[model samples]
Target chain A: DAGVTQSPTHLIKTRGQQVTLRCSPKSGHDTVSWYQQALGQGPQFIFQYYEEEERQRGNFPDRFSGHQFPNYSSELNVNALLLGDSALYLCASSLVYDTQYFGPGTRLTVL
Target chain B: DQQVKQNSPSLSVQEGRISILNCDYTNSMFDYFLWYKKYPAEGPTFLISISSIKDKNEDGRFTVFLNKSAKHLSLHIVPSQPGDSAVYFCAVFVQGAQKLVFGQGTRLTINP
Candidate 1:
């Protein structure tokens, strides 16, 4: 059984540009959630996707969005990236709000 | 505002001893609590969890204790080893919500 997996171990983007990070949830999982971990900080919930629709969101702004496909894979998109956007983006998968399994995460560097 | 808080930023304990890390929460509505361990440049791995209805949950070398009256919880590791050193995060799950609120994490170091 493969665990949650994320693409592009690391990424670099310039200000005002857009970037998309991908995630494949663990096998037998259906829900996907995204989180952001800044330097010296804990991971903060960005949003959660279930049934191909965003179910709940955190304090993030509209610029942060996500999508879930039928296969339970997910993608996080950040538009008009700012310097503060630089952080480790983590993806977690679960079965209907149960215990979550996290991925290695994609490190986004906004220059 | 941070619902969960780990007051101690770091702790050092001698190997083979017990290491106790504490966490406090301000939200009474949080029904589930969890502890996650993270290594450098890696996502956090779930350690243990306790539901509001239970006061304690144990798994192998890890034990999580909850005091709902005080809104406090703790993770205790017995016979701490050097490999146990890592940043530990305490998280809470609100009822009817899929989101988890995390603390600023506590870095644990076990000296040999």
Candidate 2:
């Protein structure tokens, strides 16, 4: 079976710009969670999507948002991006309340 | 503040030796402890996990130990191999939150 997948392997955007990253959950999974991993640090929780609704969110600002579709695919959108927003964006999928399996991250560079 | 911490930034071990990675958490309310292995340019891969109610969980060469009273956990890899050279992160799952709080990763290097 295919594992979780993410799109636009690499992206470059300037400050104040907006970027959208996409992800598809692994087969047989329904929940999707997003994370941001800066260089030299572990992934930080962004938000989680279940049933097409955001179920939980971390400490990130409102500039960061996401959506989950019926097929279990998801998208992460960042508005007014700053240089600090440069990081690896990861998408993890799981059956509700089960172990999360991550997708190869999308590397975003905000200059 | 970082709720989870992996004090050691990196470690080196002989190929045949055991590698131990440690992690500490500030909260005792976490429901589950998990270990994830990540390679360069990739997302973390789940290694193993232990419930708060249990002290230990093992899967093949990987094992995780939890000490709730001390709010500490550890991952042990026996007979470390070259392919095991990667960054490892320890994460906590809090009930009702549905999000994982992760520690700064520890990079492991297995030498031949």
* TM-score list, all predictions: 0.98, 0.98
- What is the alpha-carbon lDDT for the whole of candidate 2? 0.94
> Which ten-residue region of model 1 chain B has the weakest summed lDDT?
B92-101
Model 1: per-residue Cα lDDT over B5-110, one tens digit each: 9999999999999999999999787889999999997889999999999999999999999999999999999989999999999999765668888999999999
Share of reference contacts kept by candidate 1: 0.73
Cα lDDT for residue A102, candidate 2: 97
Candidate 1 TM-score, C-alpha based: 0.98
Q: What DockQ number belongs to candidate 1?
A: 0.80
Model 1 residue B111 CA deviation in Å:
0.7
Consecutive 10-residue window with the lowest summed lDDT within model 2 chain A: A94-103
Expressed as tens digits, the lDDT of each residue in A1-111 for candidate 1 is 999999989999999999999999999999999999999898999999999999999889999999999999999999999999999999999998799889999999999
Q: What stretches of model 2 exceed 4 Å from their correct place? A: none
Instruction: TM-score for candidate 2, please give it.
Output: 0.98
Error of 1 at A111 (Å): 0.8
User: For model 1, what is the alpha-carbon lDDT of residue A82?
Assistant: 98
